[model samples]
Target: MAAEAQGRAPDRGEGRPLRWRRRRSLGLTLLALGLMLLAGWGAFTVSVQRRTEQLRAESNHQLDLFAAAVQGMVRRLEPMPATVQLSTEVQALLRQPGDAARVQAASSYLRRLNAHLGGMQLFVQDQRGIVLAASDPALVGDDLSFRPYFLEALSGRVGRHFAIGVRDGVPGYYVSHPIHDGAKVVGVAVLKIGLEPVDEAWGMLGAPALLADSNQVVILSSRPEWTYTALAELPLERKVDLQVTRLYGDHRITRFPLQVDLRVDEDSQIVEGVLPAGLGASGAQGRSAASRGMLVLGRTLDGTDWRLLMFADLRPVRQQAAQDSLLAGVSAGFVLLLMLLVNQRRRIVQQKLQLNAELEEKVTARTQALSETNARLRKEVREREQAEHTLREAQDELVHAGKMAALGQLATGITHELTQPLGAIRTLSGNAVAFMQRGQLDAVSGNLAIMARLAEQMGAIIEPLKGFARKSKAQPQAARLATAVHNALFLYHQRIRNEQVTVHDATADSPLAAWCDPNRLEQVLINLIGNALDAMREQPQRALWIDAAAQDGRVALRVRDQGPGLDPALRDRVFEPFFSTKSAGGGLGLGLAISRDIAREAGGELEADNHPDGGACFTLWLPPVPHDAVP
Candidate 1:
């Protein structure tokens, strides 16, 4: 009995060992599966992170190239206009007492000047502010007293750049030279350079570039649509936030947000935010996560109301993290399959002892197939992530290209606008100098007063230019639509008279007002009026009718012109930048585009349609102003 009991104990003890072995094997399989998953997840996470960094680096590099190209183009074109003005001034001064013979001789000289200068327009004005001769004969005998350049030159300030304007019904610059006769003021020689040359010049400057006022208002851009926007309008802050949040601070990436202090350095440029540790992850949650990082590139232009900024976005690095997560899932599945195979082999081998070898072989084969499937999935995820990254880069490039093209058109428009006033000022100053030298103190003082008035006008014109060129700040205020329209009309009063375009203003007696920038509203009016004038340029009975009324708790201002009706096809795209029916060299195509944007930003709407009486009509709708507000 003792021997039998001992034998059973041995068998039981052996069974206990087998059970312990089976449990140990299961634990080992699970551990191996967990380790495999952990390793695979780790690798995927690392790979995704690395790829994200690479994509960000590539995006930044592309932005850098764009910035560099824009900088080069701006620098090159910066000095050309000033140089042309200086040369024209010198030549015009050489011809004095610009009488018929002298005027004829000046005309020949201007012709020669135009011939050599290539794309530059030249004209000569006498002391009486009459166009004695012009590179384009069509402008001869035209009175330029109402022009800003005429006023500026008559004031005696030299080498001052004027805001943009229209001359002889065309967009051009008017640079002047004082004709002096033995220290006596006699006449003014003027140059009217068409803006097409400037456009052509900007075209040569690769990449998109914008010449903006100190406030970051786009004065000119390769992209016309951008012209109406100030620096503040751009989602630069948002872009900075995105960059900091996604990229953190990867030195490999460029084009970060920056605060540029123009007063300190003309060539000042900086990248905003320091790179955070752990791929830009800040220790703090929301505070650091805001991602307020940016790259600011800037350059001052001839110490004027102009500055250039180049910026790019960096927010494509988050995709890498998704790839890593996917890889982790793949690795886990693979490990799970391996564990399942081991479990199946053990269960089958124990349950059916005869099939143990065959089942083991089958399990091994299934495990191999699972491994191959995992490998393929991992490859596909990597490939998909890469493709998405590439597509994003391509989209960014395309957007930037579109912006550049628009900026070029804007630059041309600005050049044309500024040239007219500058030319008038130059001629006026030259004549003023000649008069003072001739001992005509009375005339000099008179000219000075004219100059003062012109300066004031220039100041007024610059208000909008500054507003447009400077960064946008929310400066909403109660503005009277009637008063604003009157102010705008005052600026173009002389032009209206000159063009024989009658203006009929019938503003409602009730005070119509809205919260807006007065200067910006005035600009919208100017643009509308300017367009009206252009539309009536060929019309026999030219007229502009302005009617302001209060309706539906809104102030509506309508500007109707007697001219050729607008086409239905053009109406939809009339407000689109660079969409113009005028000749290529005729318009910058931004006036209406910017006007609409301004109107919308001010909670208003600008609409255009053919009037029932045969012409185009532009209506500006604004929210009603309060009854007790000051004008």
Candidate 2:
């Protein structure tokens, strides 16, 4: 019958609280999930863009180096053909092409030079383009009349051409200079140098690098398969010329397959890599490795028709960028989530305040109704009286709870404080007992007196707690602030000793005079010191320093602790009542708020901030009294 009378839904008092809790939980969960998704999405896009830019810059730098290498190689090898024509060995061989001894000696000398220098097959050819004494003895009788370099040299000018060797179908650069026999051009001296050495040098760089001719043919390539390939389709005229000269031998002018991913600049670009047709068709998975992304940069060599190119794998850079951006975004999102939590907590507190106000209004109305019904019904008056008693008891419980919080901190220190004096009394009493047994009357009396003093010291320690518990609304007086500091240290002496905490009195030289109740001030200091001890529980070294200084015509009493400083984000809320960083049952966070109120009543202020060196500094600024009014 009672459940039916109450209706289908639970009471407002019971179900409302549960409903609010559920709402809060749902909101927080949704917010956290949203943060993660937003962070991931934002991270991925931003990371890709930044990674691309960085790789582009790196590719450009590599391109500069590549171009410089080709230009430097050209400068080094360009003069060799003309310079070798003037070589004494070459001149002797050219002066007497029919001399067998001179021919052998010249070919041997050319072979040694070609081996030491970074070039392939340094040789000599006659005016008719016939292979004369050569670096390779097998090429001595090879025909070269079909080549353009020899024809150009016979016209009394230095000539250069890239063509296949007339002796073998192997491609090489042909450079020729006409030999002068006393001011008349008699024959042409030619140098045939292969590009294999340049290709080998490019391979050692650990990147895909290549050199291409004016016709866009990949003449020298670090990757063997890429050689003889063209970057783009060749025109008919160039193709026909290459075919006639047989520059690339029997190899087809195939195009290197690449898919452009992005263009970094005119000289540098990015591409996606995959196995080429032949490699893929042959099922050579390991042989032809796939690249995620490759950066390629190209530049033309100065004074030459060749272009230098560099390619690098950019997969690692992109991956790192992704990781870095995700970490940054997640960190930012976490900070934002914390801010949301704090804002929600603020709203919850405001809601609690509103509920309290509404409850108070309802109670007032209920009291008025009970008062009016008392005359009509005496039975209800007793019930109303019981309700008042219950309300008073609830108020008392709240006060008791506040006192318990302070007492919990004092409890540990009290135990440690009494231990030392109690031990001393025991020792002295034991000595007295021993002396009495030996019939030493004077020594027994002396030990008894010492025990009495120890007992009195223990009483002195217990006396303050009684006064602290019975706090009074006492008015401020002109008292020396240093006295309160000393009392705090004295009360916490046992805790300090037990915890191995070092205490410093920076204001011992100059006493701090302030207008405040000494007992109340001492309680505040004890509270701070106890809190410091708890904070430094995890610290290896514990220390506390009390500093006093004059600031803005007021005496500031600062308590500093060598413990982890107050969190910057939570510093503003530290003085709020019932706000605590400690775990459940540790504290109610009422101490600092109460202390601040007491300071205001005593014409003082309390402020907290992080110290310059480390830890937290709680400064109690009081109205300064003259030295004459120190008491």
Among the numbered candidates, top TM-score falls to: 2
Write down the worst ten-residue block by lDDT for model 2.
Answer: 277-286
Off by over 4 Å in 2: 1-42, 56-75, 84-119, 126-128, 148-172, 178-187, 194-199, 202-204, 260-291, 357-631
Question: By TM-score, how accurate is candidate 2?
Answer: 0.44
How high is the CA lDDT of each candidate model?
0.61, 0.71
Residue 226 displacement in candidate 2 (angstroms): 2.0
Candidate 2 local distance difference test against the native: 0.71
Off by over 4 Å in 1: 1-353, 365-498, 505-515, 549-553
How far out, in Å, is residue 447 in model 2? 70
Deviation from native of the Cα of residue 159 in model 1, angstroms:
99
* lDDT measured at residue 153 in model 1 versus the true structure, 0 to 100: 60
TM-score of each: 0.37, 0.44
- How good is model 1 by TM-score? 0.37
